[model samples]
Target: MDIDVNDSTPPAPEEYPDVDGEPPAWAEDRTPLGDAIPWFRKFQGGMHTKEGILYGLLISGDAGVRSYIDDEIIITRTGGSSERDAEGKLSQVADQKDDTAISRSVNNSMKFNIAVGVVIGKKNKILKRKLPHAFNVMDYFRVAYVWHERIDGFIAVRFRLEKLELEEKSWWAEKGSPAPPRTARRKWVKPIEHICGACAQTYYRIYMQGWMCLNTSCSQFWKLPDGNDPPVELDYDPKWLDWRHDPSDEVQPHYSLVPDFMSVIDDSDPNSTYSRTSWKNGIVCPSCKQCLSRRFWDGWRCDESCGFKRVLNMQTISLRAVVDDYEVAPIRRAIVFDPGPKETALIEPEIDDVYSHPYRRLVFDLPGAGTVTHFVTNREINAKPNGPNDLFIQLQQANLGLRRYPLSQAGMPYGFVVAVDSLPFSEACDPILRVMGRLTWATHEATDKQGVTALIPNELLALGYFEDMAINYHDDGEDTLGPTIASLSLGAMAHKSLRMKYKYYNGFTKGSKKLVHDDPVLEGCANRDWRLDLKQKLDNNELDWPAYEAEWWRTYKANKSGAAREAPPCIKTQLHHGDLVVMHGDGVQKYYEHQVELEKGGGAKLRYALTARHVLPAKIEPGQWPKGQFQLTKDQDYKGT
Candidate 1:
């Protein structure tokens, strides 16, 4: 069909190929769509086929689609009044948004289509999506090109554009296997306007196409039409903005508890440290001492290091906690408190000294004044105020009350600031309580591979190492060698691996031994100021000098005996997820070597690893045992490998 999409009528380029004379190399053996396309003279050919064309086979999957084509209006169409319409009565009823009815019609045309097969109205929610590739759609009609779908349905189509057509298009859709009912042809509705109003400008209309501009400055806003309701707004004073949203002037940390010196944020969600005071304001992330500056993103910034960014504005609450009818929510008060109108630096209460503890004084600024808790003797929150012991009892009860929801949500009971409640500084221990419950061991051994088992230091406790004890597990009895360092867990688990390359070093040797004073092998080129290509790497730039030549020969003298025999080396691996393997205290790294390997299929689903290993500072002989990846040393003190 010679569709008039663009400028002028013209002959199809491939339909008139020079068979005798010689076809171009590209045109030789061209596929159906590829051969038909005239690529060389596109700007010229485009004059004729501005609107492209589409061809689709009536595969088994597409045969049934033609049945739903609406040649004319149906006989029994009705309106809301329940009055029936005959023949031409409902002829003008075209813009109804009911998707199912539209799907039943299966409307389409040769040039354009608006079929409501799957993505009916935009009301369908997508449970999941592939993001960048998710809503991928090809459309001839720009205004209606957006193909939204339900969680299950999908859409796909392809087209061939011609040069002659104005606003040219070429398209076709076919399924791989047989479909129940598919339509081939349907009426195409040409987009009369260049830009959809909702897209061109601001549109606040009840229903329309495209993502409308939400910015208030744009015109074309859809006014509240007849029989439509508007959003509700309450007359809140401007002061609430400072208290609820911006709290830089409100929160102050206690300086009484000496151990609690690190003045971190006190937001309920630690992950949400970047809860900015302003939602749309400009801000930037600053360099934080604790590397937590990026966490509190509030807004765009003129300069980075301001340490703020915005958090998502939405909050999710559990539904089952409320009444059956969720139409109304119980009265919950939100309060904004500013300790003083200071410009900046309102920190969570800190404790400078254990003796100067606030005692009963409210050290931290809480959202409400309802639940006053005391530290309980047990690991819980006590709400009663009889004494410090009473506080412990109250804390115990509080702990029992807080254990129901997902740990991510339940862990943060320093709930959003509410109008009437006073929570104290000791409440920092609230999270500490949860941490205590998770840690099974108060005292344990911290061992190094050198067979040195040091008492689990107080430093580990101060750094909150035991806070995640529930997750750190190892086995009862395990024998491990080098390559993978292995730790025997209290619960019968081994986290890392150790693969040892053993060579007997006896005091009595038959041959002349070299007592070299220095390592002859050159230092790694990485420290040298040179950029060499792959060629230089293969060249023997190392150990090629006369000095190294003698050193290398001496290193291998009389050292070949008693070396382990290599018979099918069935290597045992101990690679576990999130295992931290540390090289410690002794100067062993001064002699050993280490390297990391990226294993194929090592982690399929969620396995990601980062490694730090010991690289020998000393020279190793050529073709020595323990050469590559699994080389370890018998001496030297190098930590953090």
Candidate 2:
């Protein structure tokens, strides 16, 4: 079949604008209604508040709920949680109860003289028009009317909202069906006001048939004076629907449609005077004008695919300046050597006169786990050429292609960059390899009592942290990974802590609610009295090891309803510049997890962590192996001193 390739080829698909891949031309010049205002949770229902002030309201057109929307007016039903019976099945005929706090807040907005931003959900069938975005911002609105109404035998609170700027043209108006002229005023009619004899609550005669006490709390609620049943079919008074709101000059919102990003300190500024918290808020893209959350470690990027990205230029800071700024406190050694069964304190090793090394070696042993060795580097390594200071500068200048990675199932990227197997042992990575070699040697000496072989690292993970960035508690436990893991710290000082994993931390069972297990469990935590009592029983020979374990489980199951508590850190220490840390034994990874956080206060603006690990070759796919080999040159290798 000798057919011409050009003849057989299909013509290029008709090109319309790539709506998802590219921003429209008008996106840069015109501001989007949704982006101009602060919408914290755009997709959620109910009201949105900022700084304890109600600022926005989200209305969705749910079934059996009446929510009408036009150009200038919107009549919406209040949100309520679904009621369920004793059998856990949803109730059919019961009235949905509104959150008491939310109802009170919404009712009091008028009294507080607050104007709320209105955003309409696309599910609103009353809109009768498709919207360009998932949600359409209909400008600021003031609550014109609020009253309790009975719908389908259930009491529901209804709100009537009028556009604040009545003269302005509505953004949702279409050419085929234009919005009614704002200048045309509706005839105003005052509804007859009634005072309930039982509750003394003032209500309006909204229905043409009759008036009744609408207050749910009153004994005469929804009851007529004649003691007759109210009509199931009700008709609203035409006059009440035609009520008009007079323009008011009092209602003013605290936030503006377009937030002023230029007024604040520029994030790209070289000076380190500003706190990282200042730039943590959402940023408005200069190219697309769309607001984006701070998702990247280096800087901000337009998620709308506007091809706009701003990478922050970080400068290496002096360690002396950082120490001065932090008011360097004296390092504290572990006070409790042994935790004595009941306590969860880390057992610090005694620094006896053994092997005399240049750096101070501090080893912390974890019972039933492994050991954590901390090699506190001397002044020579901290200040020498091609040392921590130089290495920090080299990392800053090198293009390591570091970025935050999505390590969890949720797909949300981390706050800090985790560049794994990207930089080999060469040039910028030479110092890391040198430190890893020293750590391997130190690990062998430290774990001599345990008789564990020191594993030489074949893989490296370089992590970069900006101000306010941190790595949360997680284990590097993988089937392919060897027993030993080592890391070298550079630039800013950090606090590294290792803790034992709690059994009920993730969950007691599948789909069960996870227990709160954060550090510093002062109150609402499961008391340690049970453990102390059990330990006493064992010490008195009342129970053996197996019996003791069985009794512990029995007590744990019995007190399962008690608040969950996290185990305190077994080893807590500071990792200064040029410091090397190592963890030996697979049990360490299985039973414990570690976290690293940058020291607070106006300290160094940047930090780098290079961790080395050994990956079993047989576990990896043959085709997925990394290209090129890394070798530690003789000069680059470090042997103790």
Candidate 3:
């Protein structure tokens, strides 16, 4: 959970004046007899009183509080008598248990800053108190009534404190062009009522380095109080020039990932459709950065004779499609990484987080998406152990809503479920997180663009592709989706293809076409609740694999067409095991759709992919979803109707 600090000022006497000097106006008659307790004042209050105290704390510039309850609270179980000072205030308790309930409550109240003592063997040799730097002395705890549980924990007295020489003043002063007269003085930055840049409406304490404007209607970009200059653009290497052309599988090589199966038609034969110049307009090699021209049969060859060859299974093209010849774009769109080899071990280690799953692998892909990064995390889970080496296999299974989604004319090639802020950092996940951040920054040196910075991944998709399962063409064009999507492929080698959406060349003809467009909003779709039936059938042993395939095919054929209308052939790329694919550029997700399919004749029976995205903030809240333990849907970032 993100940390939220209270920063407000107390109201004036007239605004919430003490009625007859008894209490603040709102607290006068309405104050319950139970509320007379002093300790509970820190936590329980209505809207007005809550703001009142928060404002008081901020105006006083106090960074923290040193709370002291009655000695009875700490020494009750030990039968110790309470003592008092000359002022009649309860003295600090002498008899205290480290493991008592009171100790736990205090520790959990805030994210405390601490100084560790030297460790002697398994225990600390000494301990010392390390207070916040903004702490200053004040007495606000004298107003509470000293009662036991009836008064919400007896508070004998408490002290408010401010840190000496607070350092944030200079920073706040720099935000204003000419520091305002009121702001010129260095005291405390209270909950200032300022107008939002987007809607010109007043907001309370909503300025920060990584916070968005509080205006819900405006949807303005995130900006800091002082302002920020857009990032610099990445300079392109001269060697990575544009080399795209028309695509066709007729002259491309065909290879099987499992077996050494490759075939090339003899161009010398008179009946051959392709000759020595067949691959003149082929794409570049994904393995090596060389252009793969169509000169040989089977697969295209690198012009420099790099010897990089593979089946023309899928053409690797830019994230955005090349509608015409005048387009100048990046030669390569996705990147493939190699992590050497896998280690053979018994019971593969899986690290647990707060979520239902664990970190199944060690590869991460972080892509710079203008201002923030879109990161990928790969995790694997299984019901049963594949072998003795699979230590992370789960005997207890939890469903994270992974299911197939329907596209315009085809379905997603694999099962996928999007996770919203679900993955938490742990010992196993932290290393990858750190590495990805550094790698993304390194990549920005060559790919950075103005007005863009690396952002954290907000959504995760756990995708599974069974044998013969495949996803069709679909662009992630949801308004909530970010400009980039990064994915890490694991398990089996799968064919990931990106196809250009069909738009008529003639404006007049476009108006007459009735092409099917998948609704971007996925709320209330059949896929949401439909997956439960499939899961139930599988669990109950009532599903027949052969019958399932036959039924799916029947539905596929009836989905308005055997295939989506052809505009142009698709560009393909191979996602080998442990490869990372970062689809950059805002135009990419806007103009193109992609699919993941099982490579024909591949050795592995299943493939898995972990794809990460930055969903819009409006859709991340769970309260907007259906009332249930789990909600599964095909829609990407769909807001409820």
lDDT of 1 by residue, 198-298 (tens): 44542222112222232233342222323232232111111211111111222221111011112333335322222222211111122221112111122
User: Per-residue alpha-carbon lDDT of model 3 for 1-641, expressed as tens digits?
Assistant: 24344468744423431111111101111121112222122222211122112111211111112221110111111111234457553343443432443333222221122111000010101111111112111112111111111011222212112211122221112122242223234343333345767677654432222333443345442334545421221111111111111122111111110111123333343222222122222333444332233333334544353566554332222211211113211122234343223321111112222221222121121122111122222222211222101211110022223333321010012123332223322211322332233223323321343344634454445555434557777766676665656665544456765534453111012445442222121111122233335435545668665654454334445543334343332344555443445665665565455677766542213444655555555544554222112222232111111
Q: Where does candidate 2 clash, by residue pair?
A: none
RMSD of each: 30.5, 10.7, 32.4
Cα-based TM-score, every candidate: 0.17, 0.70, 0.26
Whole-model lDDT values for every prediction: 0.21, 0.59, 0.31
Q: Which stretches of candidate 3 lie over 4 Å from their true place?
A: 1-451, 504-565, 602-604, 622-641
Error of 1 at 455 (Å): 5.5
For candidate 1, the lDDT comes to: 0.21
Q: What is candidate 1's CA lDDT for residue 87?
A: 31
